[model samples]
Target chain A: MNMSLKNTLKMAIKSILSNKMRTFLTMLGIIIGVFSVIVMVSMGQGATASVTQSIEGMGSNLLNITLTDRTIRFSNDNLSELSMLEGVHMLSPNINWVAPVKYGLNNEAGTSVVGVNENYMVINGYTMMTGRLINPLDIENRNKVVLLGSEVSESLFGQFNPIGESISLSGIKYTVVGVLEENENTLFGDNNNMVLVPYTTGMRQFRTNSIASITIQGTDAASIDKTQSKIETYLMTLYGTDTYRIFNQEQLLSTLNEITGVLTLLLGGIAGISLLVGGIGIMNIMLVTVSERTREIGVRKAIGARRSNILFQFLIESSVISGIGGIIGIMLGILVNRIISTAFEIPISASMQVILIAFLFSLFIGVFFGMYPANKASKLKPVDALRYE
Target chain B: MILLDKVTKTYIMGEIELTVLKGISIDVREGDFFSIIGPSGSGKSTLMNILGCLDVPTSGEYYLDGQEISTYSENDLAKIRNEKIGFIFQKFNLLPKLDAFENVELPLIYRGIKSKRRKEETEIALDSVGLYDRMHHKPNELSGGQQQRVAIARALVGNPSVLLADEPTGNLDTKSGNEVLDILESLNRKGRTIIVITHDFEVADRSKTEITLRDGIIVNRKVK
Candidate 1:
């Protein structure tokens, strides 16, 4: 019911509607700009979300201790004493190497041979699908008992229980004790392509004297930092500086999120440049329109339209163009996100924050670009304008 | 009511100084059907521009209803034009994009009148111009005469104190020209002040008082 505003808006809409194809063409730039911005940002955030979820799935309380030097060795008694530290829930000293696995005529190349103990299954969150995991007695007796990952079990003993079946780790015979269920949340690599055996058995087979890598699970997420520091201080006393490194899961997660956040910002910035170009397009068209309608502006002025009235008329016109373009861009962005998500099997939802920012920035572009031309139109001498042929 | 005292307008087109209106004086009282006739280069168009509040004279005073507004700001002049002056141009000056109804509604809209009142005023103006039935037609859809009538409706919509017509009937055929003259006469009879600037003596002869201008100066006057 604001009389002048309503009147101005009606006039602007009429002028814009008069040139359907030209207006649409002008809007195309903004549409593509907003579309790209939304899609790129959503992809970055989607990647971040999946990676963060997988890492958190393994539990934030886990710590990985690596002995960089081959000379440094940790015995079974030394690892057990570290597990008794405050806020430490569990610990597994692991020795791992890659070799071919064979059972009968079936051979799976590049099988990950992981040496672990009774605490390994619980700490790494592996659940047995059949049979039992390697027990404490297996380590003392140095028995060649192993647990088969789901994929290894499938290849080495298809459709049949791999329990009690003997498999060879590079020509050494090992009895299969259990087959692990399929797990999809492994951060480093596919846990389903690995073999689990007692550390003592692996040491003898691989001929290594030291256990270099160790995984520890804290009692709770809040205690992970404290327990890691305690273990670091304890390790410093044993091996001193530069000989060992402890990787914290929470730190890794944060570092990954930071990287994705920067990438998203970078993509959004590139898309914003396109939007700025689209704004220039609006200005170009608006300038052309002002000149073309010079006589009309004079007539309006003669009929008593104020300079401000004429100014707002063209400004509203450009804003309307960009506003509508932004809406279409958003709808298209969501649609494209859907198509891509389906094609690549990645879950992508265009972030609402990004959508809202793009919409508002587009409107701002309209007004900013429209100012010069509208001012030119408003300042025209009525007599000269009316005389324009 | 309108009065001009010794008004002059100068144009400096890149050091070629030209004085279009050289100390021209004009007067017209309320409800008067006044005409100023001159050929091209006679400065009548410049005089009309000044009277219409579209431009100001370089030197001298312009008084509308006894208020000296020759030195008014651009914004003030716009207000005077909007509320006290109505314009009808030879080209019809109807915004081609707007239909007859919207054309008539423009002045009231500029005046910031409410929609309901503006609609009522526009309807009345279009009815008086005898274009009520064709109010929905655009400028292109209407005949030359009908387009001129819509221009007249637009001029009359704001109920301005003076109607300034710069060759209102110049684009029309003889019959349509006379039709416009007749409407002007009738409206003048109804006590509305009107001023017509034209190069045609016949058009001047229809007015109650007429003047002839040659070389930016009024040379003669006739009481018709």
Candidate 2:
């Protein structure tokens, strides 16, 4: 360290020590700003991680096609057409219902009903826990056989095994063929509270050909984009642009990630404003310090010290103030982030680039704001300075 | 050695010119213990500032040793001050943040002296002022007399050709003030050319030569 810098650092530390309250107050703005950025970014990153994990759990490389309007009908013919696509590995058309099932009195009343095909279990990676899944023969004969999810089985059968047991849906009796295992990674909603019936049985009972959504599994990761493109082209060519909607799960995930990134930056940018305020605080305090030390400036000048020396002394003082504050703020921010992460089940990470940028920016703030005050102190006429009371 | 020929300095208040030092001339040889005694507003301070290179005369010639310094730029004047002269102030203007050793080492620092050499020279200078033991004490921690001694030590550290003191004991008790004057006399006796500015006749009596000023002009000179 240069001599003047050593002295200036000593003086700056002393100045801060002498006025503890003021120093802390000056540091408060920076602390809050840094703390806000760390917490916001950590929460945002955790939320995005949860989303990605949920997407991966829902069967990898999956696509969803929903036919919402009556005019956008995709019947057996359309399903065959989609199945013909080379990249599409499987196409499972689904029909859904919400039939309230009951076993005992008021305590056992519940509604858990789902209507889907036998292929949905295989394509969506679901397996039967008891009896076999509904076969193509059951759908062709329109037999009233059903499969119950684990929770639905327990709700309607009261602890007994529900396989081969009969349950009433819309006052019509159907025999339960199997129970599905509980899904542990349900993010959107409770996937295990659902029940599935053969597609023909659902259409025969509900009397509607309205399909809820289509699940398509691609042959491989590379073929997903091609499969999606082919589906979009087929749907648009067959039913026009406004008829159906196609959503790629990967695209949805990336868009969500983009939103999280924007949120992190916006939070960080808003937090950056307080650093600017802290810089202004340093400037104001330095101005006061220069005035208070005018006599010292004169004494040094009168005793063979040059103008540059006086300027350097004051500059170092202000720079050290802000620089120390910046370091302390960074440390405090990380500490608070860790505490929050522990409480909220999230990980908080700060890049080395961010630390370096914050440190250098604070240094620049010191030099930029300190220049005016240091120059003012240096330019004072020695005689006038000495004459100051 | 110092020489001044027809030096004039003026201050402008709005439009009217206020001349402080009107056509003054004087000379002093090396190793002289000289005093300039004057009443308030008698221009002694202005002349001291000019001699110390803190101010330039509005008109005149000034030569220190053999070099003309009256027309030097501010930067050049500062360089000359750093290389050839040291100043002691009436208030014993020690920097409050610094201890005695650091204050004394300041002049050498400006001269770009290495820290090891500056420390050695500072120690010797403070020792000469009888303040080596108190070298780590800040100005506020020391007595007025000790602060003035540290100021003198600071002046001596650079080994300058001239030591200029302006009312060096202006803010002390007589006992402390006398102690400072005694130190200044001893420094002069050891061959550091010293000049003191004071209005007190008793303080002026300590010098070997005294010049009295009144209303911007030298009125009398006594060789003691």
Q: What DockQ does every candidate get?
A: 0.49, 0.36
Which candidate leads in TM-score?
1
Q: Which 10 consecutive positions of candidate 2 chain B have the poorest summed lDDT? A: B106-115
lDDT of 1 at B52: 93
What TM-score does each prediction get for chain A alone?
Answer: 0.79, 0.73
Q: Model 2: clashing residue pairs? A: none
Q: What is the TM-score of chain B alone in each candidate?
A: 0.98, 0.98
Please provide TM-scores, in order, for all candidate models, with all chains considered together.
Answer: 0.83, 0.75
| DockQ score for model 2 | 0.36
